[model samples]
Target chain A: MNEREPGIDRRQLLKGSLALGMASLLTPRVLRANDSSTVTLPFERGRRPLVAFPQKRPLMVMTTRPPQLETPFHIFNEDIFTPNDAFFVRWHLANIPREIDINTFRLTIRGRVKQSLTLGLHELQTQFEQVEIAAVCQCAGNSRGFFQPRVPGGQWGNGAMGNANWKGVRLRDLLQRAGIERDAVQVRFDGLDQPVAQATPDFRKSMSLPDALQAEMLVAHSMNGEALPLLNGFPLRLVVPGWYATYWVKMLNDIEVLNQADQNFWTSQAYRLPANPCHCVDPGDALTDTVPIGKMPVRSFITSLENGGTIPGGERCTIKGIAFDQGHGIDRVLFSVDGGQQWQSARLGKDFGDFSFRPWEAQFIPKPGHTYALQSLAINRIGESQRFGARWNPSGYLRNVVESVKIHAS
Target chain B: MIPVWMFLLLLVGATGFAWGSPANGNDREQGSILNLPADPISFQPGPGNDLASRYCLMCHSAEYVYTQPPHPREHWIEIVNKMNASFGCPISDEDMTPLVDYLVTQNSLQPSPSAQHVQRDDLKETPGQSSTQSGDPQKGKTLYGRHCVTCHGPDGKGDGPIGQALVPPAANLTLLGKQSDQTILDTLRNGRPGTAMPAWKNDLNALELNHLLSFLRTLSP
Candidate 1:
């Protein structure tokens, strides 16, 4: 990733989804540093022989505490569903709570609903059906650090996104019970993410009327089958499936239904993307337009051995990696065993539920002495394939380029 | 000190239990507060801290900082120089000696230890089997493809796609055995500690790190 600070270009809608991937397996706890901190080691170390499980270790993306850095960008998880211990955290304010008493905490859901309701964690669990999905939560600016020219935000790499098996009550269900007013046009979620301006504190976001009603939307309180990891927007968070995690509000203290869309800077002025279809605008022409980045375009990469790989003859190889598009799933994965010359469509494994990731594979029989060049490309049902570059957006939002690999048979 | 607005806002928000309010979690999180006394936390640096967590972990993690294996002096300088130039670390020329001293000593694996100090860690690093068992070879193959191949070439021979990104061009893994296991471990874990090599602890688990190490050992001359 080039490390030049290219100031924000007014060109495309600023919908640039970049998370400067500064890594470290940090959770919210990392940001909520109180006077002194310590960790009590896991008592059952003997039961866990290696205390260190270092297989397929994912790299960490680092981001600093705000005041130390600003939001719009921050540290991110190397993986899509960041591990609880390693979720990148970024907030605009310096004063953050070290801990919020669960007993005293509450998630208020109010707005244009038939009935205004107050719900408790246990009540939430007992009353509604618990639905879980492994979806990725990515900041709007995930990978902003890689913007050929730098921007003034948390310079993230690819780590801000994280996948999680979120469990919680459905937002749709809650809205229905609240009796969403007949005229309500949008639903807003204001987090405990510290209101930027106290005088009029405004750090709010909302989903459209239809999205708020979708079944995939959730008011989650748990991650990875455990109580929500604290740094992961614990107490409560919004998990929006298949969408950028920016909408996944953490420490959600308020959920309000409104008759109109939120007009706060967070929405109206921020997260906006170009409404045009200019993927590869000339640098000169690129200097003018800007737009909001939204709905991550379809993209995939072969996570298995990178572009240049070498294996002894007749080696059985398992090709692995992940792919993502706005809504449509992975249609087919094509492999180019004989370099990028000829192509063969490899079999994609079973589909993991709706939005969760499914591991795909391709087995190849190798020959000795000569090296093989392999590359993989994914296409959705609509038949759109991942490209080498999504075209240079000044913000460098989506780069779902196809990944290639080189293999040698000794 | 508690900000009035924060405390007041929270109090009102918490107790305002209206006619229909959501339930509070009541989840007793004992270890929630960072292990610190009742005081405000600041991102300030400390004195004689010797490799403070802030300076090192800003880019890596504490887990990476603590468990690192040690390295020889020259290799350490190569790392320090890299971080200062490549990764944007502000390592002053003055801080070099002490920083290196702390790392080389605290993280040092004494070839001259009191022999009785043999720990299990020593056992694991002693040139284990050749099967690439530390991590899922399948996973490593992919990770290598994604990360390692960028510099180590397609076949661990040091010619990679991102190889050009490295100023000195990436290290030739097949030849890392010249250094001891501790040196190799320390470098990988701490990322040359303060250099561009980046402490890799956050990205790799010990096993995965071990497997990558195993793979690199195979690349040695």
Candidate 2:
């Protein structure tokens, strides 16, 4: 059931209610001593302390205020689905909601619609058909740290990605209930997070009308079969499968049907890649044209072994990793031991969905006292495969170069 | 409504409950709350340290700047300007030059030994007099407002809001004027263990610590 309060502006109601809800919430409990533990990523200026946030393991902390945390790379080897506690967190705005009361929480749909409808969590569950899909949510700058001539952004190692089983209702069903007007060109999504200052642009993102109606696009309430952690956008999050995590707005509560194209700061100025197909330009070259970053390129990682780690000497070791693409379903994964000079097919583990991370395993026998450069290449069904050389872009987005790990046989 | 077969499938999924299984109806029904940890890092103290703290820490912790790979002064300038023009950071034009100076000195890509990696033992062994030059209390007051007031109260009573949350709370600085400069310097450079006091050596230079010490003496009752 949808509710409409008469003579009330939806935007003002949302803001007023949010302020009241925040005021009534309990004071956040500060944790004990700072952990002071640290993990050094394999780059200069890569040493980061390990800190535990609410409902999280001690992850590599990128920043503390808005709480940008990265999943430790080893978590990927533990299971195919990233645990809810260890899923990476990133918030664009500083003043994220520390508490959410589901009783008052509403998912509001307005703008260019037949009628604005506000639905609660319970109605969203019972009134609509439930769907579940597994997908990888990856940051656009996941491996920005490894970018040569290092870019100025979140310098994350390959830990800014995680695969999860997202459970919720379809976005199309809700938009249909509100009845999208014929002139609707895009659907803009907003969340509970707010900028610290009034002058800062509110974090908002938009998708084309056609893309919003896709079956896989979900307003996910559950991650990995459990309630999402507060940092990971509990209550609700938009799961834009196959797209960079930038488009997957967290703490999602508002959906607007826009008659005109959105030129919001986030959509227009930020998270953009070069306009070229490769989405790249040479280093030191100024970008002449740009477009909003979209679907993720194919990427694969060797998770079981760490770089500069030792493998059992003169013996066969099982090498395990994961490969994912823009929902095209990985057709084959090729493994190379001598730095892409030769290749062999890795065994695919399971098929969760086209969008889910596909686990792959291979075997390697190394000689004692010698080091081998191991790399993995994934090719999706549409014939898109990773390149041997990395493509350079100013923002350091869509880095799907064949990843290499140098391990010695001890 | 879910069909009977799909309901059975969900039941099966719940019973099995492995990593990759589908939804099992165990999703949380109530709203959640989070108690975030306090920031444990601070900006490197220098000329424009106060301005950097006022403008930068408004949106994020100092770790964002600390963790970045060293860049040229021009890069830092561009980043600072972008923060003002694009991200709506309200840094004034007059303050921008000094702020850029602070960033450049601390995070320059030049081939100099990193101040962050200097060993605690080496710092302890170094002659303390070199850093104990005559300090300016006025400059120290500005630095204190930038860095310490959040945890240590404005009156140096260790009664600030965040300090109250700590296990071994922030120090009462008013009582420390009688202590030797070296002892105070060591405490500021190498933070007290088993407490919330973080080391300032990586963030504040020797002279800045001396200035802070000079200001702390003025708070004596």
Candidate 3:
């Protein structure tokens, strides 16, 4: 679509013909001072040449080694349930399984259970009552690039997140079948994705026993009513509704119940945030104590307007976006036109679930010669709202600040 | 000739092609490994760069070092230290200083002696003033297609087909509008000393360099 735009040259056509596998050099670009404020702005989604990966459509590619793909923002503007193919892909380890025979693959539920159970795919579908839930599974560092005092990690735009309808047996039911021991403290999950080097830490995550027993948590085998795309953990994955995707282990294979807190590298060293209410630490402040990143906070973004985009004066335009929280459910989304001074309530869309993305819309007429600061602030049921300034964290986890876009009135 | 299933198994074993599920039934998503383009970055040969190539390349490609926002010497030191302490990067204590020194020398936007005079002149060219007045976008496009299109990609998203293999990934040049022209010019001439960006001083003339800069400006919003 962008190829037809004026000023874009034949370079776009050349990119389409080039094999992505060839080696090349790229000149790095730095940010300008006038374009950005004291607070850092989110990186704009780079326009990438269309290339389809396995079981996925052409996505905005970030890194290819373990395959990191960001879903375009316009997809979010369409529906609350992000399509299975359009779902963003993130893998930590280099070795992910290529194929699994349904008959041979087994899910083992062992540690701290009275009766250890090993169930095949057919038995897993027939034996237990299949349930479905719509939930948002966002990476802990979804907007890491926006963090001030810029932390080092995956430089992600706002697309490292997606919401989907998952179908599977509840973790509570599966645990009941396994018969969890009373002294079980935590439940750990393991996936087929493994690191290449033996010395590297294995990708693993554990949750408190109470969180494990929540009815919302599911051992999902199917996404959006079909078998999961191989890139998105084909046969099985764990769905922890209203939480970050770290706990939603993909290509799930094992469930080990722990009698104590998980001391693994993934839990203890990585995916950690400050234990404070704001969940932020001062820049360069040595963290004294940290807890594992859990529920994502209330956040929202304007999708209709691009940063620095132009609109005609006196034109009535309807501004739209998506907002979600850590399962308390979004109470209301407020649109701020005159900076943060005045905010009007945007009309809310259908409720999918507490864990689903809630769409919101508002209409306004642009004023001539005025640059409107379009911002959306999402408030959850508990009255927790997004902050203007993003809280700083070392690993760049849980950035839920109000997102603002700048548009010119001409 | 091998049977279909056997051939599939052979293919999986031959290449570590164990990524997507086998196409069963009407599933269009069946495939083996995703052959993403290889990373285009390679450290320029030097004493410290050789050290980086030896140790750092084991876990990550040079893209990790190049994609970083140019940081201070202390920041590079902290990063190298953290890699050793936290991620268990194996580097002898003797080698740490040289690696850090190489990174600072390469990544720091601070001008080298040869580019010092050019940088001074560039700094004086304020935002409103066009330092690249003689630059030709048409000439710049030809030069870019020949030299840079592989890694930076056609539109400067750094999604060049080969650039996908990089650890840190390629730098998105589309965002350069926010930076001063001097910074971009310096990077072109110096080639980020330690990283994959090679110095273009030997490759292009001053006028040609200015033209390349002009072409890059068109990529920005």
> Least accurate stretch of 10 residues (summed lDDT) in model 1 chain A?
A44-53
For model 3, the superposed segments whose C-alpha errors exceed 4 Å read A1-51, B1-26, B30-37, B44-47, B109-221
Report residue A242 deviation for candidate 1 (angstroms).
1.3
Cα displacement (Å) at residue A22, model 2:
19
1 versus 3: better TM-score goes to = 3
Of the two candidates 2 and 3, the one with more favorable TM-score, higher being better, is 2
Instruction: Report the C-alpha displacement of residue B30, candidate 3, in angstroms.
Output: 4.3
Overall local distance difference test of candidate 3: 0.71
Q: Which TM-score does chain B of candidate 2 obtain?
A: 0.48
lDDT of 1 at A383: 87
Chain B: TM-scores of all predictions: 0.37, 0.48, 0.43
lDDT of each: 0.51, 0.78, 0.71
Better of 1 and 2 by DockQ: 2
What's candidate 3's DockQ score? 0.06
Model 1: lDDT equals: 0.51
- lDDT digits (tens) for residues A175-285 of candidate 1: 887787778998888876552112223467777879889888999988776666444566788888877766777778888999986776566655555556744453334
**What TM-score does prediction 2 earn?**
0.77
Docking class of predicted structure 2: incorrect
* TM-score of decoy 1: 0.54
- Comparison by lDDT, 2 against 3, better one: 2
lDDT of 1 by residue, B89-183 (tens): 44556777666665555443322111211231243332223234544555566656644564568777666543433334456676776665545
